[model samples]
Structures are given as C-alpha cells and as structure tokens.
Target: MQHFICTGGCDGESSTPGVCQAEDCKKEGEALTPCNCEDGLHGEVVEKKDEDED
Candidate 1:
C-alpha cells in the first residue's frame, strides 16, 4: 500500500501527495511525501518488495 505523509512534524497525511494541512505546516507549506513504510518509522520514502517480484 502507498500513501502520503507530511514531514513538517505534524500529523497530516493524505491519499494523494499535497501540502500539509496542519496549522504549523500552513505557514511553511510542507509537501507530503509518498511512502509505504509504517507511519513515523521513516522520514524518507520507503518501498516494500513484493513477494511476486522474487
């Protein structure tokens, strides 16, 4: 699964990548990053290998 998350120290996340909606992020205009890792487990995008890819 894939999703978007905010890196501006806020809890903002969306199905599509976009600006963070947190009050603080509104000022900084933080952009959401696409990732597949567990929430907060990674600051950068993480991709999981599909078993079928082997």
Candidate 2:
C-alpha cells in the first residue's frame, strides 16, 4: 500500500524515503494522482509503502 505525508513543516524522518512533489501543494481538490497521499494545504507529500507489498 501507499500513502502521502506532509513534508513542508516536517523535520527529517528516519524512515523510508520520499521524493519532492512541490506541485502537490494545493489543497482544493482530490490528490493530483491516485493512491497519492497528499496534504495540499501544506507543501509536502510522502509515499508510505507497505512492507508486505513485496
């Protein structure tokens, strides 16, 4: 599985890595992409992958 996390005001996390999607910083609609966990209100997005997906 996958999900998004707000990285704007976040401190560095000691977890799986995620890329920058600064474009995802808009909060008025559904996520720009499917299964994309985005908090547009904040300029950040992270993908939380399931360990079982392998």
Candidate 3:
C-alpha cells in the first residue's frame, strides 16, 4: 500500500513509511477515501491487484 503526506494539518491517510511519530499524523493504511493532512501534501496512491488480473 502507498500513502502521501498530508500538509493541510487536517487528518487522513499517512503516506509516510513506517510509524509516523508526529502527534498530528493521521495514518490510514486502508482502502478508504484519502483526507487532507496539512495542505498541498497529498497521500500516495495505493494500487490494488484484482484477482482476475492475477
């Protein structure tokens, strides 16, 4: 799964790898709508493999 760092200061999926020590870091490692974290910063796009494709 991939994630992007949110620079909006809000809360969303964390793109940062490993555990984010940031208190405000809203790490979301799932298949859900991404939320702005701080501003300008966008979460990484996670690619999923379809069973049919596999």
Candidate 4:
C-alpha cells in the first residue's frame, strides 16, 4: 500500500504506510502540525517546536 504525507502543518493522507517523522507533523487522527513522510526505510526524526502562548 502507499501512504501520503502532509507537507504543511495539517493532518492529511499519507502516500506510504508509515508514521510521519516530521517534528511538526502530528500523527494522523491526532492533531495538526507540519509533517512529512519518513525519509528512509527507517523512521524519521523531527525537531519539536514550542507552542506559542497566546
């Protein structure tokens, strides 16, 4: 199967079947954030950003 990716900070479909490694990308069905498909066969690593307090 193929999984999609969310290049922007939103929860979208994945082209590949795997978890998103983008620090900003939140897991599907969870929250919205900047995320992309895993880079390599291994999982991806993303830098966690702090939420702004309004």
lDDT of each: 0.63, 0.35, 0.39, 0.42
| TM-score for predicted model 4 compared with the true structure | 0.25
Clashes of 3: 14
Ranking by lDDT: 1, 4, 3, 2
TM-score of each: 0.55, 0.18, 0.20, 0.25
Q: What is residue 54's positional error in candidate 4, in angstroms?
A: 8.1
Best by TM-score: 1
Lowest lDDT block of 10, candidate 2: 26-35
| lDDT tens readout by residue for model 4, 1-54 | 334544334435555455455565444344233334455321242335457433
Any runs in candidate 3 off by more than 4 Å, and if so which?
A: 1-17, 28-54
lDDT of 3 at 23: 59
Number of the predicted model whose lDDT against the real structure is largest: 1
Which tens-of-lDDT digit does each residue in 7-45 have in candidate 1? 555656777868776775532476788778665665465
lDDT of 3 by residue, 1-54 (tens): 445443323334455544334454343333334444344334343334235422
Candidate 4 or 2, higher lDDT: 4
Alpha-carbon shift of residue 42 in model 2 (angstroms): 16
TM-score rank order: 1, 4, 3, 2
Better of 1 and 3 by TM-score: 1
Better of 2 and 3 by TM-score: 3
Model 2 bad stretches (over 4 Å): 10-54
Error of 4 at 46 (Å): 21
**What lDDT would candidate 2 get against the real structure?**
0.35
